[model samples]
Target: MGNVRLRQLVIAAGSLDVADTLADVLGLGEAFLDPGVAEFGLVNRVYGIGDQFLEVVVPTALTAPAGRFLARGGDGGYMAIFQTDDLAGARARADALKFRRVWNIDLPDISASHLHPADVGAAIVSIDEARPAASWRWGGPDWERRAAPGKLTGAVITSAAPEQMAARWGEALGIPAKGGVIRLADATLDFGMGKEERMVKFQVSLPDVGAACIRAARRGLDVVNDEVRIGGVGIVLSG
Candidate 1:
C-alpha cells in the first residue's frame, strides 16, 4: 500500500440516459464521453464532483464486461476504484491473494488493474495510478473546474458475511477494518450486513440533505428520508 485513496466509483447502467438522470438528481454535470472508451465496446460518462469522479459505463457489445455485470446484477453500482502510487506492487499483492486481473490500461500518464469481483467476493475493484495523482485523464481536462455542489464522502457495500468481506478487502487494500467501515484517504467504505453481497449506496457531503432531496424531487426522482434510489443504489445526501 502506498498513498492509496478512493478515486472513483463506476456505475454500470442500462444506458447513458439513465446515468444522466441520476447525475441530474445529484447536481453533477459536464458529462464527458471518451470515444476511446467506446471503442472498447463500452460507452462511458464521467462527472466531476470536487476532486473525485463518478463514472457510468454502459456496454455496447454483449461480450463486454459491463454488459455481463449488468446481466448478473442489473443496473447498479459496479466497481470501486482506488488511486494508488504503486500499481505494480498492488497487483503483486492482489495476485498473492489469488485475485485475478480481468482488465487493464497502461499508458504514459495513467495505468490501472481491475480485479475480478468474483475472486474478491465483492464488487470489482480497480487499482489506478495517475501521473500527477490529482489529474485524471479519463475525465478529460479541467475536471475540477466542472460545476458540482457536493463531495463524495463514502460508499456502502452490503454482504451476507459482512465481517469476512470487510476483512478480505481490508487485507487486499492494506487498509485496517475498523468496525464495519474501511477508511481510505479520501472516503470510507461502509460495509453493512445483508442477505446478498452488492454495492447498495453512496454518501455525498452536501450543504443540506433536505434541500438536496427537494432538488431530486424536482427532477422527478423518488426521495424518502433524504435518500433516493438510482439504479438500485441509494444516493444518501448529508452535510
Candidate 2:
C-alpha cells in the first residue's frame, strides 16, 4: 500500500446517553451529529477529540452494520481507521495477507476500505483516503474544542502478547517501532494487558490526569478510584 497515516479511533456505545455521558466524563468536546449516511442505517452523532474523531453509532430500525457490531461486542470499542494515500494499494496488502474486506466505500474526495477483525486479531481495520476538505467534516463546528497543553499522549490496546500485537500493527502500518510503542505522526499505540483470552482496552489521554479523574467521578460514572471501567475495558485518563 502507499503511505498511510493512522486516522481515528471509534467506540460504539449502545445508547446515545451513555456515549454522551462518557464524552462528557472525558471532557470531549461537542458532537457533530450525522442524521443519515448509510442506507437502512444512520450515524447518530460524531464528536471531535483533538485530531482524531469519535463516532457514536446507533443502529436504525433497519438494522445497520453498527447494530450487528453492538449485538456482538455489546457496547465499547469498535474500529480503527488508518488514513492511506492509495485505497487500492492498501486493499492489495490486506488481500495479500489473506485479510477479508468486509466493506468498501468510495465517496467524493474520500474512499474507505475495511478488513475483517479475525485477520487483525482485534476489531475491524479501515483504511481511508480523502482530500483536505474531508478532514474538516470530522473536526468542524459541531464538535467540542479543548485547548490542551499537550498532544495526544497515546492509546492503550489490550492484547494477548503486547509485543506480538505491537508487531502486527507495525507490519500493517509499515511503521517501525521503538520500546514497544508504535509512533505515528499524530498519536501512539501502546499494547497493554488482556483478559478472558480477548483483548479489552480503550484509548485515553488528558491534559491533567488528577483533574480529569475527579471530573469523571463527579459525573456519577463508576470510577473505581482513578481507573474507570467502560464496557469491560480498563480506562485511565493520563496527562
Error of 1 at 156 (Å): 0.9
lDDT of 1 by residue, 113-189 (tens): 88888876658888899997877887887777884767788898889888788887786787878887899887899
Once fitted onto the true fold, the runs of candidate 2 whose alpha carbons sit more than 4 angstroms away are 1-4, 40-42, 61-64, 133-152, 161-165, 176-181, 192-199, 222-226
Q: Tell me how candidate 2 scores on lDDT.
A: 0.63
Residue 174 displacement (Å), model 2: 2.2
Clash total of candidate 2: 2
lDDT of 2 by residue, 1-239 (tens): 55655556666666777666656666666566655445537555565666666555666643676677677667666677777676777777777767788888777767787777666656667778877633634444533353223233455666667677677666666676565688776667777667522335555666776766777677766666567765445565666
- The numbered model that scores best in TM-score is 1
Please identify model 1 stretches exceeding 4 Å from their true place.
none
Q: Which ten residues in a row have the lowest lDDT in candidate 1?
A: 206-215
- Candidate 1 local distance difference test against the native: 0.82
